[model samples]
Target chain A: MSQMEIKNITKKFADVTALDNVTLKLEENKIYGLLGRNGAGKTTLLNLITNRIFPTDGEILVDGESVIENDSALSKLYFMTENNYYPEHMTVKKAFTWTKGFYTDFDIEYASELCEKFSLKLSQKIKTLSTGYTSIFKMILALSCNVPFVLLDEPVLGLDANHRDLFYKELLKNYSEKPKTIIISTHLIEEAAEIIEDVIIIKSGKLILKESVESVLSQGYAITGSISAVDSFTAGKNVLGADTIGGLKSAYILGHLDKSGIPEGLEVTKPDLQKLFIHMTNR
Target chain B: MSQMEIKNITKKFADVTALDNVTLKLEENKIYGLLGRNGAGKTTLLNLITNRIFPTDGEILVDGESVIENDSALSKLYFMTENNYYPEHMTVKKAFTWTKGFYTDFDIEYASELCEKFSLKLSQKIKTLSTGYTSIFKMILALSCNVPFVLLDEPVLGLDANHRDLFYKELLKNYSEKPKTIIISTHLIEEAAEIIEDVIIIKSGKLILKESVESVLSQGYAITGSISAVDSFTAGKNVLGADTIGGLKSAYILGHLDKSGIPEGLEVTKPDLQKLFIHMTNR
Candidate 1:
């Protein structure tokens, strides 16, 4: 059974249509990348799924039941946003206690362990932690919540390289131990490409493409060679983007070409997620 | 002559030595990555150079003279921080006009063009712009300033994919037309690696490595093959990191190996800047 399903969902704010006839089915035990440019309605779709906002039209079902204002259904999901709201004068320990009451699966022991790993001070007030620390605190809550579905929107905003790598490793470890559905909305595509099993690309409030990560990347190839050779080879192909400097040229093509057809001294490589996204969206 | 020079720079905050006798030279017409883990004193160093704060020991020379309180030398540099402090009543156009007085090379026409390209309203007050637009406003100032030295500390913090790509392309175009000494401090290493000519890695408030980009990546290689073949090849080698799935293994090894020595059915590639930075700092 699908963990979450949105059928013909549409959300409008006055003259702005944030989402238009968006239909998506999220499976269980997989990592999905929710990607798009700014103002592409990725956040709107996520908010609708989490019931933070209601859809203007159509229906959303969680476990085959309407989710609007449904406590039992909402309890099965955890949604973490870029900006977290914490009450004033609340210490880390108090926040943990508060979340424990709301989430039955909240593991205080695991949360405490994560705090220690991230070197967070349990006694410090929520407002006293640095931006990166605040993110860690929220991540701890999300991970220990142990919900069937978790949604993270730009979770690594303020983290450094080491901390980001650590977060990814911990996420994978937790997933292996307790399989669940994860939807991550982020701009750092290449970094998360390996972990994401599927991808959903949104553009201008419309769903552009939704497919497995492997299938998405397999549709494009990057070719580099002399300017003349590259220009000739890319003549009739669907060129996503091209960069040229002096006599060297590199073009991202929509379809793969046979190895024998590529010119000598030219380099043909697989397109990274970032390159593909840039090419696809820019076009 | 160097655009900026740091001689025996040391900063101490009570018992903490934030920067430890660091000395470096920044030449003109190059982009340098001022990279390090959090609390590595990158912000402190930039503050010292910009004369916003004084160093505990040593000196910063701009154009062969100390820049402390010297308006003539300081006006040649522009530093864009995470938070821009413009009066709430100030409009975008007014901010541009005010910046013209501080920067001798400020170009109003160019600023207007960028404002349009970023879809910014000139009449909108600074407080009315969204977080992403605020960043774009600051970026416009930095680019249009045409200063000899530009320093950006996490300038692309909240930007989405399309805007970030636009920023990179604009930065490169500006650099190619008007070369300057630019230092960007960011956690997104791989995104910036292609644009930066030099890299400076810092750790624990100490300089770890500073070299050309090619030289840094030349020391590490990534090898992928069958689990057994990968394990045997990486044996006795400095394995910075490794990822395994089923029978396939990918190992990041220190030091380069001859192409002929690579095992059959194995793929050897260069390590990405982000991965390399994480491995280096974690170790």
Candidate 2:
């Protein structure tokens, strides 16, 4: 029953505000989708939590205890970053050994198993691995650390289709066996939609929405029909966006749908997460 | 109509073969999805076409002429490579001027227009942009070059969902206005599936698939039902793969499916591009 709380956090880098009066409570044993556009402060927020940088104002607490240079509280978290963690000449085996010092529950056997599954050789130097393999290596470290809170940033950055599928399945399997609070920030919204339970969306360094995936998805829908029919149906509603092809049209609406009020030729379907994200952050 | 032919191409690096004997014909004015896993020789093929790398044993011809050390033949092509084209500290405007020297049809006005649309400042240094902006810069160059053959490598690497959508729309519009041969090498299959006219899948330095998207997608299907029912229906058939969850099962088939022959309680769906790709290249 662990929980992390950010109380009115504000981060500023010189004149630019990276995060503005953002507050959120993250509970344990759940997967979160941290979504935002590039330079929207997703990475900045993550950095603040991991003590890589200090917020201009605010208090962060884990289980009611502050997480400022407090090794015990910080030990529960693992951040899988984009930058290389190990030196160029260090082998995967050596990096595993180095990680064991920081992570109390680091599982070397599980790491070896993952390497075998991914066909990554432990003897190979960190710099020799391809982009996809580098991502795999980082993912292995994050999953094998056995930490309570895991932050994955663009985990599938260079992975192919099969590897991506494998990574998702493995992540789910690991979560099911040992439930932990996981946060994944990625641009591949559609692929990671099903894996995420709750979503936390930010725009321009400001918290916009935080809700369960089901509730968010249920609130928005797209209607396709003749231009006139589609326009009439969405005219007064909270229209998100619209696209037209000749006399046909599809309009995205963010509100309750009256099932019986639909026009004869109109077809309604749930809008995908990407469409919703684009519309929400476009401004 | 312009056409490029890769005839019996074979590339070797010291002791290892980078690309096996491969032959294919690429027609003009079509978008080709060049897909493969890492180290699958996709980049090798592109380099060979650009005459940046030589084939160990084969000939490449564009418009019935050799492309080896031929400036006139190479002038018709523009390669948006992963390596930085401009030296460090070079501005976007300066790079455009340098490109105009090589690419005869490089349109400075169109490049400026694209920079405005993509929100890329012409005066900004190439090295100072973020990952996403770097991608946008390259995409603008590829689209504005007006080359007969444009090869784009991971064009949407760091783009957000909104930017990715904009880039795809812009690409389609550009292609429609001026028809040319465009080959995109990317790992994001599902998003680009609809935009591609044909798919070229390479695996382990060999050409495994070369077919129109329509034919390849139409050939595969998935059936879901009870485990026993699915097994019975797919037994001894051209089954690609299957997944089972308790008593329920879904099997992917590679050949034509008899709709009427499907079991009474079974459901069917067209298999997506990734599923087919995973099954084809897993070995």
Candidate 3:
């Protein structure tokens, strides 16, 4: 098991501030959903943790050891970036051999099995692969890397519906056999909501929320009723947002709902993760 | 309004066949979901319809006229391809102008409005934009083209949850106002299910199913109960798939599910679009 800590981390690029004094601790063997709007600094934080880039301020540590210039500490982590960095001429088979050299603990046999499972040809050149195959190749490497901490950035970029389902199921199966701290930075929040145990949200380079998925979700409730009645009931309440269609209205509230005080003809249900994320992240 | 007819289209690349003997009619003023697995020839079909590539056999027509070298027929259609074909140094403003030349009906004001809504700067160069911004730029063009037939491929590739929500809502708003024939070829089936009136599924270069989304979902159901009861009840039914956790079991069944005939402990519910697509496309 491994834990990662970010202490008051801030990253600056030229004149822009990418991440601002963000501090969070990742528990051991937990799946985390790193979510934010575009350019909200999710990638910047992940890059800092992997030592690909340095923070303008603050410290990042894995197991109390700084990852900066620390080969041993970095070796225990695998960061599957959005961009492919393998040699263009390298075949999948050769790439596996080459990655095993750096990741030492990488299971070559398991990688071959995954390649077959995804129907990827080992002899196919990296540059010849389609966008979907390119993502699959990188995912296969991350899964077989045998690292204590793995970071996946938009893991299912071009995958089809069936392939995405297979990837999620395989991810769960692998996590069950060998627990690891996995952080997935993706825009597909609903697809990852159930699989991820914890959620970390950032906005405009600031950490807004960090909590278990269930606890964060428990704070949101949706009430549906006539527009006038909903407006009357939700006046001055912590209403996140609302949608109205003709005479009907659905208001999303961000606090506990008293069941006894509820108006008749009103319906209350749990808002979905994606809807909650949108309401929280919308400008 | 415009209609597209794909008559016995087949495409071949070298020794491999991409699309084989596919025939389907895209009705006027309806949103259709073009769904398939990766390498299932969804893109090939779209490319053929747009005259980007020629079909090896049969023909494609837009408004009852052949699209091959037919400028008037092609002018009514807009295909938002997966790749960005604009010049590397072209600004978003310039790209909008260039597109307007070919697509004379392009609405420059609406394009600028969409750019503002998405926070995309007109001065930013196309090659300098991020993945999310790139997708947003293309989507803005597709929505503001003012064409009678619009085809979008993976329109929300890297959009965040908030942006995707905005896009879907905008798409529906635009469709309601313009009432054009639109075909969305995307991997996010569940997100597109409600907006898409009909679904056209293909498997291994062959047309598999074409029906209304409601009709397809109505034909499938999910049953949940104890393992023994689920297995016994599904023994003679056409079971698509099942999942078991400890003593609990959930089985997916096809065909009509008689409400009163269901076992007492079992629960029946409609299957989601993603689940149904996965079952249909999985090997």
Model 1: per-residue lDDT, tens digit, A1-283?
4488889999999999999999888899999999998788999988998899999998899899878999988999998886667898999999999998999789899889988887888899988888888888888888899899999988787899889888998899889998999999998888889889999998877888889989878877989999888888889898888877778988998776788988787899987888788877763
TM-score of 2: 0.95
Q: Which ten residues in a row have the lowest lDDT in candidate 2 chain B?
A: B274-283
User: After aligning candidate 1 to the native by TM-score, how far in Å is the CA of A15 from where it should be?
Assistant: 0.9
Off by over 4 Å in 1: A222-269, B222-269
Q: Which numbered prediction scores highest in TM-score against the true structure?
A: 2
lDDT string for model 3 (A133-231, tens) is 999999999999989999999899888988888899899988999899999998888999979999999999999889889987898888999998999
The 10-residue segment with the lowest total lDDT in model 1 chain B: B274-283
lDDT (C-alpha, whole model) for all candidates? 0.87, 0.91, 0.90
TM-scores of the candidates are 0.90, 0.95, 0.93
Report the number of the highest-DockQ candidate.
3
By lDDT, highest first, what's the ranking? 2, 3, 1
Q: Global CA lDDT of candidate 3, please?
A: 0.90
Error of 3 at B244 (Å): 6.4
DockQ of 2: 0.80
Q: Rank candidates by TM-score, best first.
A: 2, 3, 1
TM-score: which is higher, 2 or 3?
A: 2
For model 2, residues B114-226, the per-residue Cα lDDT tens digits are 89888899999999988889999998989988989999999999999989988998899899999999999998888889799999999999998899988888988999999
lDDT of 1 by residue, B1-283 (tens): 4478889999999999999989888998899999998889999999889999999999999989898999888888899987778987999999999999778689999889988877889999999888788889998899889889999998787787667888998899889888888899999898899899999988877887789988878888889989999988889998888878788998888776889988788999887888888877874
List the pairs of residues colliding in candidate 2: none
TM-scores, chain B, all models: 0.89, 0.95, 0.93
